[model samples]
Target: MPAEKKAYPLRISATVLEAMQRWADDELRSVNAQIEFVLRQALHNNGRLKPAKVKPLTDDDTR
Candidate 1:
């Protein structure tokens, strides 16, 4: 199954935006994907990522 998706609006300084775009390109990801990946990593590192709310009936949801 595909991952669920959501949209968010953000504001940042031009310098930060430029740096993020360059980093995203270097990582071979779109800016949005890179941002999401970084945020997920940070959340996991800080032990802030919540567990899945719904239990899976099978292995499919585990991925």
Candidate 2:
């Protein structure tokens, strides 16, 4: 099952938000997704989140 997501209201300065919007556009991600991506990366770098393990694909998996 996918993890459940909870929404939280955020307040930010206009300058920062505009910058994030441009960065998000460059990455082809919505602002929310860009924020989440940055937060997740920060958590992983700080050892607060564990890295995800991806299973190796096999011949049958490609079918």
Candidate 3:
């Protein structure tokens, strides 16, 4: 089964939001989906997003 969707609250300047909306439309993705995709790409590029080899870390390692 697919995972449940999670909601996130984001704050952005009007100009940036408008640009994002336009880009999302051009890519045929919902604004939320576009933002999530962009964020995931960035995380993966920076090695922040990776498969878990062991158990999850606590708050200390996260920082």
Superposing all C-alpha atoms, what RMSD in Å does each candidate have to the true structure? 5.1, 2.4, 11.4
Q: Which stretches of candidate 1 lie over 4 Å from their true place?
A: 50-63
Ranking of predictions according to lDDT: 2, 3, 1
Across 2-52, the per-residue lDDT of candidate 3 in tens digits comes to: 447888788899998899899999999998889988988899899999843
* Residue 5 in model 1: lDDT: 90
Q: What tens-digit string does per-residue lDDT give for candidate 1 at 1-63?
A: 566897789998899889889999999999888888888888988999964467458888667
Model 2 earns a TM-score of 0.81
lDDT (10s digit) by residue, model 2, range 1-63: 456899999998999999999999999999999999999999999999998877789999999
lDDT of 1 at 4: 84
For the record, the alpha-carbon RMSD of candidate 1 to the native fold, in angstroms, is: 5.1
Q: What local distance difference test score does each model get? A: 0.85, 0.94, 0.86
The ten-residue window of minimal lDDT in model 2 covers 1-10
Best by TM-score: 2
Segments of candidate 3 deviating more than 4 angstroms: 51-63
**Candidate 1 — what's its lDDT?**
0.85
Task: Give the local distance difference test score of model 3.
Answer: 0.86
Question: Which segments of model 2 are wrong by more than 4 Å?
Answer: 55-63
By lDDT, who's the top model here?
Answer: 2
Clashes per candidate (backbone, < 3 Å): 0, 0, 0
